[model samples]
Target chain A: MVIPVRTRGTTEFQGKYPEEQFQFYFRQHWIRLFMPFARMILITAIIATMGYFLVELSFASGTGSRHIVIIMILLIFAIVQLEFLIHFYNHCLYMVVVTDRRIHRIKKTLFITDDQQSIDLWVIQDIVKSQHGIIQNTLRFGSLRVEAQESLLRLHFIPQVGKKYEELMHLREKARHWYIQHQSAHPSGSAPHPTT
Target chain B: MDLVYVILVALLIIAIEWVLWHLFVSKSKGLIFPLETDESSFRVATPIRLRLFAIAHTAFLLTLICSALLFRW
Candidate 1:
């Protein structure tokens, strides 16, 4: 039996193998990052102006927890950037790892949620791409549903859903051909067990 | 003391970073490409992003610790 053990970056990321190859990789829309980033900018600007005034006032009065206020500002600054960092970490981690052998939807999250689902590329039954709503249509990022016999995995907020759908179909065809070739190369019960 | 509280909070943030790294970065880091993950579809988000972030974050933590200790509040 060929068991799969976690081999650092290779196994988890559809790598660490001889035959597997990656086709495409993408994350959710850039808007997700942009939204938070814009917010951080706006908030930082407000905080900076407010901090300057508060500091001036505290200095004039000579009696205020000005140090604490500065501390609070630093804390707020860190928190804002921290949110972006967390988003970046999560965004990069949770991804669609499509290999020649299988389509791996690895949902790795930091906040106590880790979901990893994989289906053989040859077994993919249907791939549906949808772009609804004004934002989705105008921005051109939407969702993809890869349906199989046992389960249906939906990748939401993926940019270029149409392109991904087409790629999925192509990969499916390639996977089918690869499987056929592999099966033909090794006939049933013709070779040794688990040696290859 | 307030300084103690601030220190504790800063430490908490560090802990969170550590946890986040182990939980997500270890499993899904796509920064190095072949160095990090050799798979075809799996690529790190950006090569130097994690490095830059770590440097900036460490600087922030160090500053925060220094403030907490020096400010006495």
Candidate 2:
């Protein structure tokens, strides 16, 4: 039985391996979610206002089906909450997970698309961090573009991307060192594969 | 006639919710994003709160219809 290692990545993702060590698990900045969250709040406020007016109308008229109006409001609120939940789930599910040896770009849209690409750390040739706007510059959030031998992985609007870029560079060097040591230590067989 | 109308609307709501959930929620369960640069299992766990909230929401929808039927206003 492989005892699952305790890490943020493992809890967020399922089916863990004992050997897969985590370097960094990066999620999108909450700023990216602010618009959707604000929209939900605005919707809830509108529903609440409508509900209050409806209840008042019922009280004033005395024949306006009070319980029915209340129920309708609650139903609308519940449905909107469900929509927000779906939106939040989609946001949470999109992540860029960097393990010691692998960089996994995992994205799952709200029931629309799921695209996951894994690039070996050693294969990544270039990593660039770009912040385009004043808000991003002030907030220290930016996009990271990773160029590999075959594929490119981009993480956009992530927080403190400069730090993450540094971390990736450090991890890349470690991977290179490990790869070199493994190559020399093996020279033939005997040693197991450095990493799968 | 009102009761029939409420019941029909209730059923319609349920049918629409069923289709939407199936399309937007259930279909994503089978996907497991690969990690470890190899074929390692990385599954997204469906949040339990979503299921509970869905059940409560469905109950509320039914209650909305029931209230409409009972009040007759």
Candidate 3:
């Protein structure tokens, strides 16, 4: 007998990116997400393991006092798991997408949902890649700082993103050329638009 | 029983550390520093706090083992 499993709501980011317009979508490095909480998890795990032994020894000594240690260990493990889950969820929810038309920033949390911000290519004043230290230089990954007339957004700790700066600049140049052409053709439609 | 428990605890702690090192700190693209690069090289590298925490973790484990041994004897 074969058992059938139903899988619904399995769609992956439906129609999020138009395939024809945007050729590539680069995600922020995964390392950035994990680094924030790695030490916390490791320390908690170590403490929990030590607490286990301490509790065992206490019980063995006829003290009949294992409650406090056991509770503390459980609390530590629970907190670690909670932190890991929160970090994973936050990482998965926050995303940035670049297209020929505009750049999209999507930020979401469990309860709070933020609307996407679309920044046109022509308005992007500068794209800066800051790589400091021998590690960042040697690793070839650094932070990308995006500057626009209205706002400044810094994409932090993007690993293996050295090559992306050039690619983005190329894309932006192309977009700027297209915008200039569009403006020359349609004077009325080319009015400076404010991004909300 | 105590000796067996102590050994098991030690093994468990080692296993946990190994897993954490492999999953979080190991030189994957997921880690801040790629495994190939030295951690000290990056400016936005793993913080000094993490190194200190690692030291404290090691010390805690050693203390646990020593205490277990002293208690057992």
**TM-scores for all predictions:** 0.68, 0.61, 0.59
| DockQ, every prediction | 0.26, 0.10, 0.03
TM-score of chain A of each: 0.75, 0.75, 0.76
Best by DockQ: 1
Query: Model 2 segments beyond 4 Å from truth?
Result: A1-20, A54-75, A184-196, B1-73
Per-candidate alpha-carbon RMSD to the true structure = 6.9, 7.3, 13.1
- Shift in Å, residue B56, candidate 1: 3.7
Descending-lDDT candidate ranking: 2, 1, 3
TM-score ranking, high to low? 1, 2, 3
lDDT by residue for model 1 (A1-196), tens: 1111224224335432355655445567766677888988898888878877886678655534777777787778778877777777776666676665677776666676577777887777898889999988888789998888988888898876677777778778877776676678776634221111
Candidate 1 CAPRI assessment class: acceptable
lDDT of 3 by residue, A42-160 (tens): 87779867976797679766644565565466556545654564454455455555556566666555445544566777789999999998867876678888899997777766656
Give the DockQ-based CAPRI class for model 2.
incorrect
lDDT of 2 by residue, B1-73 (tens): 2678678767876775566555556544533333333212222323454555556666776675566455633
Residue pairs clashing in model 1 are: A22-B40, A22-B41, B30-B44, B31-B44
RMSD of 3: 13.1
Sliding window of 10 residues with minimal summed lDDT for model 1 chain A: A1-10
- Note the B-chain TM-score for every model: 0.47, 0.56, 0.48
- Pitting candidate 1 against candidate 3, the one with the higher TM-score is 1
